[model samples]
Target: MVAKIITGKTIGGVIRYNEQKVKHGQAKLLQMGGFAVKNLTVNDKIQIFKQVQKLNKRTKTNTVHISLNFSPKDKVNEFTLQRIAEDYLKGIGFENQPYLLYQHFDAAHPHIHLVTTNITWEGKRIETHNLGKIKSEKTRREIEGRYQLVKAEEQRKQKVNLLQSLEKAAYGKRETKASISNIVQEVIRTYQFASLPELNAVLEQFNVCAYRGEKESDMFKKSGLVYSILDAAGNRVGVPVKASSIYSSPTLPRLEKMFFRNKEARKQHRETLRGQIQEVLKSCSSLDEFTSRLRPKGIKPVFRINEEGRLYGVTYIDNVNRCVFNGSALGKDLSANSLSARFSLNADLPYDLEREQEVKMGWHGNEPGKRTQLVESSPNSYQTEDPTPYELKQKKKKKRKKRIQ
Candidate 1:
């Protein structure tokens, strides 16, 4: 089980979070300890916790909120979960504290949240320092072995090979600082990308982008990193949050070590990426067409284009394999220059019919009576039909009418 302990200055906010979950039908009051009532209601439970908290006036941040998340694969029941929770509290020196234990069904995993006060009957506070790394870690391992639960390290290994669910931004789902931190930690740990550009290739799939400050700035000189959320079209959605401010401090120095390590580690997966690119390129005629075919296969092709509309570089991030690769890493044939030349030869290869309808009509170059065709409009611009002789006469009549007016 994964244990997350959060300390709060007050108990009211902590109680409201779990109680609100129960009110919303997202969780249930599984078990309680050191309370008098046999069948306590939510209000009673809140009152009891608050009453215990009022006993100790010297301690601030006395609230200890812990969430123990068991693997979803485990078939443990409520009784087993309660026993585990009790053992964890005892192991962590919180057995005597007044706490509420809850079972949350909101996530895929089976988890329990325990909320308690650190202050005791004699107005003494419990030691919470190094609780996670020492006491909690030891208890977690003991319970995992005793209950035959899946090891956390093994689960992490399994996650490294699969794509993380990073669905498109929703209408009202607000992104928090914690959510971004979890995403950064997951991506940095799982995906194999050599540099920042390659890392962004993976992060962009999840509407996240990391930035280094302007080239001339002091932060840039210090190799600082900032993270921001991205919109559907890959634009920054809000102000970038600094990496240091995040919980794990995924700063540039840390990512630089990863960059060098990934440079060598990511090389092992290049063949797989190359095979997928080759399969798509052979079946699809143009870059536009190739991308449409690739998306369904969980492979996104990122093209780097120059100011003159020349394809300068290419990168492919395989969501299925959870790997990122620049085109040059694959081979000469898959490089941007080679693919650009290959695509230029087949500019009219069926015109990506499905894409043609979706592409917006727009003006291109400095040409009259001509406009760019939708989707794959390249090499030659399509011209509008010429005016008929009668229409020309009608145009002259209209011009004459305007002059008379």
Candidate 2:
């Protein structure tokens, strides 16, 4: 069994999430623990949990939401699920707490949502520090052994491939949206990507991406994140949904925090990605060719290209290692500017568009194609042979102005 714990300030949202599933026929209320009445309506259950939570007035974030997920291969029953929930609560120090458990058949796997108050009947909040890493994980392994269920350690190893087994929008259910939400939630929590661009390198593999709006736009300025479904060519196919629309609420602010946290957290794997790049570079000549070779190995080479197609920066996403690194994050030698110079020298070609732009912008001695010194001819004199594209453009504009006048 895999356990997911989410603590919140209020129990209302978590209760409503499961109750809605039950109301929509996607879930069933399996059992109620620490409740006087065995038979209660959804509203009755919600009110009961709220009343218990009101016992403790001190704690702000007092809601404890727990989800226990069984492998799709497991044929778990309502009775077995109830026992699992009870043990999980006891294991995580939530025993004797007013909690409601419901089994949700929303996905291919069998999972239950347990909603309860961390604020005990004695008017004290429960300590949940490192609960997942300590109590929850130990309990999960024990449960897996007792019930002979698929081991979570093995499930975690196959998580990337197991994503394919999730149900879609079929059998009269909207699993597509749920599937996307589940995947994004998992990826954000599991992958160590330092930036949104780096995050996309992982998301793109699942045909999903999170996009912040255009740089100067109001949405981007306000730091908004929109999640979209991508097609095979990497083009977004459906409507770009707001990050807030998803259950996990992976907004830009939340992601920015994750970025900084992951920046240093992911550094340990940089050398592995660098080694992979070095191996590929040994067999490749140009940047384009190197990128093509990396694709088959599930490494995406993202380039920051200027208007003149000059590569200014690069970031590599090594999906196999589940790590992302900016070129300089690995080392200065792998930086875009450094790599560009190396590529030019190795191919025996002129320096790339960076140098080309220098000449165009008059940074070099003279413009490559434009005459620095104009011919000593009269201002009104025209070339007898032919007109250039720019001259033709000027004449057309003049003619259009005359017609307008």
Error of 1 at 328 (Å): 1.6
Would you list the C-alpha lDDT of every candidate in the order shown? 0.69, 0.68
Q: Write the per-residue lDDT of candidate 1 for residues 1-405, one digit (tens) a residue.
A: 788898878677667767766775657888878887868766777778777777877677788999897765778899998999999999898988888889975443578899898889777888888989999999989989999988878644443223434433322365444445556766785677766667876776667777764433455556677887766655555556799876457887777667667777877778877887898899777889999998877788877554457665567887766677767667777776677678773222222231222122121111222333334432222122233454676789899999999
Q: Score residue 144 of candidate 1 by CA lDDT.
A: 91
Give the lowest summed-lDDT range of ten residues in model 1: 357-366
TM-score of 1: 0.55
TM-score of each: 0.55, 0.63
Off by over 4 Å in 2: 1-4, 19-31, 34-41, 56-61, 68-80, 102-112, 119-180, 231-239, 280-315, 327-405
* Candidate 1: count of backbone clashes, pairs at least 3 residues apart or interchain: 1
- Model 2 clash tally, residue pairs: 0
Root-mean-square deviation of each candidate, in angstroms? Answer: 13.9, 12.4
